[model samples]
Target: MYECAVLSVYVDLALGLAVTFLLLSLLVSGLNEAFVRLLSIRSKFLWAYLRDTLDGADDRTGAWLPAGVLDVFRVLPFLRDPRPRHSDRPAPAQPSAVPDPGERAGDSMINLLYERVREIDHGKRGRTSISDIPPARFAVAVMELVTAGGDVDDFLTRLRQIDSPLYGPLKGVWESAQRDLDRFTKGVETWFDGEMQRLSTLYKRYVTWVVAVLGVVVTLLFSMDGLEYAKTLLRDNAYRASVTAVAEAGPEAYAELRARCAGQEPVACVTETLSQPALVGMLDQALVSLSIPDQGAPSVHWNGGRWWDRVTTPAHWPGFLLTYVALLFGAPFWWDVLRRITGIKAKR
Candidate 1:
């Protein structure tokens, strides 16, 4: 009977910890999403990939393609500024002398292909740039641009005229296609898919650092001392039981919150979910139960003491680090773990 009682306590403690981590994970994820959107990180990476692929150089200097090609690409009809120009402002004067079309045919062709691939939608709010383009659409756009209102023969001839680093690979794709337009389009699609896969890998690597920073910030802000919290859960029967009860009902609560937050922006969704009376009450109880003296202060505080002692709280560092690392695993992962733990508890 004593062993069974101890097992029950341990299970309840695990449930409480799982619930805490799950909630923290959700907050971190929503904040991270909002930050990513605000900074346009995905859009920037997409632009960098496009620039590197089209110009054969990631930098603005343009190793194979001419400088300013990416700038011109950004100004294409489908990609130009989205904000409406003020009607009161005078229109810019057009130059009388036109430059030779041959001078910028390569740049123009690249821009045309991009414009076709990602045509602007009239219904949605206008966006200056896009974060993604379908590989199949990109392939079709390339074929259409090279054909130039002519047949497959024109596409073949124009393909040869491509003066950039893309010429050699495109030629290989052409040969693999046996000069068939459909086969050529499929080859291009495959090529673009491979490049996009690489881009996705690079984006994940970059986002990892961003997530780490956000995790540290969140850990410090909440004073989440994982070790201290665990110790409290082990010692305090009433608190553990209360938190475990909440954890047992967590799935239904999460489902309701998810339904309430559907279609909302990440920041707004987090705000709305956290503002729920039940959630607020739970968090209040948790704050008191956890014995966190200053509700809003970070782990490191300016206590009224000597300058060195005031800001030095090395004791919380290990727990803070552990919490930060856990947060970096992301919300979906914690949610899955929470579900599994809940299932385990049910089985017992």
Candidate 2:
């Protein structure tokens, strides 16, 4: 019977992850097509122009995949040019150090880079290298609109007021353009240097965050799922309480959760179960609270403000997590980790 419960849990999770991964694969396949069509799109604004880079048409996705999962497809060896060489002449005197800075003095290397990529190949596959897609191109597209008719003042004025994440990065670049077109060209080199450093730092931060998140996700996938099944079993109580309640209880349950978040109930006095986020948060809080043994996997419980800790031993959390991880994803996880750690590529 114990084994049967575990098996049933595995079946549910396999079905779920399989469906999710399949959908992800299909979505990526669609993106492969969309990226090609987008190159023709042009706009005075950089944001609109940035949209043109994608080969796919449909990007409306409600499901958010983690950066790590997305990175696999993003950093695929065959997709991008490893040795990214700029198409434009080298920047005069100093080079634009950004990933693909152009040779132009006052002009955005990003713009020239775009010109070169299109020059290299527009519609044909195996024509232009994929690494040509850099953030500078997006920045330059916006700059083109600003620099039209050589009006720098209006552009800077409007740019400062606009709300955007890129605004900060592009500020120094534009300021360089305004101050010295020749000296500003020198400034462009500086700007590229800064941007490259910024991006590199951001990428490192992203890597650390992604790894920690994967650890947490892997932990939950193995350990808390069984506990989730147990909670589902407990919800059978609400189902038994009243047939009518069962129909209405979902909204009611949410309302009860909101009330708890508002601190209407004392910590120990609450009777209703927490929402998923709150439950996950509680498990994290518990790891710190109880001084529980730390393991590669994290554990969670849905406490209805009662002492459920006695039922689920602190020690069992790691075991359950490991068992689930090993049973469900051990092989694939090990393979991926080995490949990533060793920088080894799998042959196609």
Candidate 3:
């Protein structure tokens, strides 16, 4: 009975992930197209508008006003992180907070002018240059992305072996980023906004939601054995074998019917139940059994969800893995913030 309850939880989590994955898979192709459209207008317009509004000193350089405007904020260093013995992690500094947006132009102009002098003297040394042509940075970013092969292990392994002069500077920048990120997390612990005089439950929704997610994580961690049980049961049960068989067989019978789903109607039908990958995979397996190998170009990598089976499933079991990974990420950030704000000295 105890094991049954645990199995139920495993079932629910798998179901939840399956539901999320299915919906994502169904909408993914359309979402990709929508994203392309969104970027076409918003990305460029936002940049140009921000640039023009922030800097108007005859347009010799890009926006200076924005930098100056940022300086107007009554921001203070809520946390003092340990300065790295040798890293260019900018010492976190505070600026005055902006109470209103109306005085931005006049206030920002002077601030920008002041910042211009400081930057001219203290800009990052290894900054990449840009010309009218598309910057090589994007190419480099793509190379990094592609060479990593979408795996963390491969990315880190290759990073250590990189012998290029270009890589040495990037390595330093990466280390500094790690330091800054550590400080940011540390600052968050005691960080308070002028807007919130007291940290009410309502004011701490971000922290609260994170805690709730942690509860979900704890539940999953305790259910790991149950998850393995579910997989094993699914593999061995002859009653479940019928379900898998139906999914694997008789593709032509369902394929024509599914094809008639003009829009996302077929996938959308199970939008509440199936995650994209499970539904898509189930459908595809049935189709192939009916001797219909799909010639359709695969969906976006993020959406298709097949990559999970190919990549993650091979390395580890399925069901809500990245969710835990994300929480792991947030843990460090929150811990750092707390440490900085509370001035918790780390044990050596």
Candidate 4:
């Protein structure tokens, strides 16, 4: 009986910690998504990738293009500054002379292809930057550019004369197509898909770092100490039991919430999940019960005060770091663990 009671205490402690981590994960995820969207990180990265691919540069410096080549693309309305300008502010002065057409001639093919792709993807909708382009659409744009008012042979000859890094690979793709337009379009789509997969992997790595930084920031902001919280739950049986009971009822609601959020962007999905009244209320209640200083309290100043003291204390670092690491595994991970623990508890 003593062993069973001990096991029950440990299980309840686990449930409480899982719930705490889950709430923190949700907070961090929402903030990260919002930050990424507000800055248009994905769109910026895609724009850069497209530029590098077209210019045949290994990096963003675009050294392959002649001076003033990019200026032509920059002037396009869709490529202009995305930030809203103030009506009261004066317009910037225009350049004294038009960019020499000869200087931009080498980039014309890429420029035309980009414009065609933009028309197909965005249509009448204004877009400052394209966040995504379907492979099929990209293939269509390339084919239209190559075949418009000319034969493939003439286009390939002109492509060879251009000073772009894309010449070699594009030539290979064209040769492999064996003069069949359908085959060439399919090959272009395959090439686009491959490049996008690489970009996606790179973006995922970038997001991982973003999430890690956000985790640490959120942990510090909340004064969340994993070690301290665990000790509190272990010693305070009533508090642990109450938190665990609340968490036990969470999985069903969480599953429903996830179902409803399916296929939405991260920002939208997280916003919906965090805005749920019942979830917010439960999290608030649990956080209020914790020993950490409340954000709304006057003593919680960050620069200097009891809060700083709490932060600077050597013993608190371990807990803070622990919570930060836990958050890196993400909300979905903690949610799965919560569901499993709840199931086990029910069986007992």
Best by TM-score: 4
**lDDT scores of the candidates, listed in order:** 0.57, 0.39, 0.33, 0.62
Runs in model 2 with CA error above 4 Å? 1-135, 157-214, 223-348
Per-candidate TM equals 0.64, 0.26, 0.20, 0.66
Candidate 1 lDDT over residue span 214-332, tens digit each: 77766765667677677766656544344355458866555544454575653466654344423233333222223233356434334234322312579867877777888888887
Order of models, best TM-score first: 4, 1, 2, 3
lDDT of 3: 0.33
| Collision count for each candidate, in order | 0, 11, 17, 0
lDDT of 3 by residue, 1-348 (tens): 868856755554455344433333323324433543433322222222223322332234433222332221111111111111122333223322221334444324223222222222221222211111122322233233423244323333333443212234334434544635333223222231211223233223423443444534442432222234345444333323333454677765356435544444554543422333333333232112122224754443232344234223433334345434333333345455445544688899
lDDT of 3 at 22: 33
| TM-score of structure candidate 1 | 0.64
2 versus 4: better lDDT goes to: 4
Residues 1-348, candidate 4: write the lDDT tens digits: 868878988897899889989989999999988977766666656655665566445344343212232342332223433221112222222211111335544345445555555433432224335578899988877666565536667656555555555556667787999868888889889998998998788677767877888998787766677888887666566433443454577755555434545856534665544444332323232222322332465332223354566677889899889989999989989988999998744335
Better of 3 and 4 by lDDT: 4
Point out the higher-scoring one by TM-score: 2 or 4: 4
